[model samples]
Target: MKFRFAMVCSSNQNRSMEAHFLLKRQGFDVSSYGTGTHVKLPGPSIREPNVYDFGTPYKQMFDELRRKDPELYKRNGILPMLKRNLSVKLAPQRWQDNAGDGSFDVVFTFEEKVFDMVIEDLHNRYQVLMKTVLVINLEVKDNHEEAAVGAKLTLDLCQKIEAAESWEESIDDIIVGFEKQHRRKLMYSISFY
Candidate 1:
């Protein structure tokens, strides 16, 4: 059976979007969510900021892809196409509410806030069938770099998952590897902070 995975990230636009595409391209059954809401209004509200950078500017990214690969542009607008292929829904509710669903075979939180929130919610829900949620703290030099790093990380992780003797036996090992890598990065950052 295809592995069911949910990827939750702080912003729906950049890193998560890239990973969503890459993971599906690797043949996993994946879904994604962005924490920020994308609201469209006819006229600008006073509260609305015109130059809002949600995650990565998807339009600019897509335009870049258009220049690089015209065929890809014709095939699909990057965000919608990724969403369509991955069955990703931009969730309105916070991660806490999302955790109660008990639908995900594996939930991978891409940000620390979402990770803690999911853990709390899962503990409350106490769902017997739910698997451990994996936290993927993708390391990159800067925010703009997350998409590239996240895509590579996801691809590598997918390869490891596929090569495993069985998902049941090695899922924890996979998670441990990701967690260790993430923590090492965190500790590395502590020096700068």
Candidate 2:
């Protein structure tokens, strides 16, 4: 069976979406979500407001930001990111709200807190189901540059996972091997975090 994957982060706008895009490009079934109360992003200025709700149209948010502060949005790469985010469906959703049908085979989280929240929520709502899911925490920073780095690591992990001949039997070994390989890669400043 093809593995179903989920990528999660605090806001779902940057890190998770980046990985979602890469994985989808690689022909995997994937979804992305946030574990925050609201979507938050950097604004044009210190005083400029930048908060949005889940499921808000990316174009709408982009347009508003562009109207409010075109320079800031453009300089910070928000415009292009927003343009890319527009294609993501079921995004910016809370983890608790998206425990959909227990279909995910694996989930990659960007931080320890998000990983904890997801595991706890899964155990509470789907105790038995949680046993079958592989949740890995890569502790990535929530930023444009960091998100790009994290996407590379996530893509590497997915490629490794996909190449395994027996997913169910070899998942543990795969994770162990991936982590070991990840540490070596990190030594070269690949920055999985």
Best-matching candidate per lDDT: 2
lDDT of 2 by residue, 1-193 (tens): 5788888888746899999988888889998888888888787566754989887777788888889888878888888788788776633677777755677877888888888877777756735443477787887787789888899898888777778887667767766787787772221010110
Clashing pairs in 1: none
Question: Residue 143 of candidate 2: its Cα lDDT?
Answer: 78
Candidate 2 regions exceeding 4 Å error are 45-49, 126-131, 184-193
Q: Per-residue CA lDDT of candidate 1, range 1-193, in tens?
A: 4556666666434455567667877777776654544411111333742233333344554444456556644453443443343343332223444435555555555566655555555566755653444444444332335666766676677666667777567766776786687553321010000
The whole-model C-alpha lDDT of candidate 2 against the native structure comes to 0.76
Q: Specify the highest-TM-score model's number.
A: 2
Q: How many clashes show up in model 2?
A: 0
For each candidate in the order shown, give its overall lDDT on alpha carbons.
0.51, 0.76
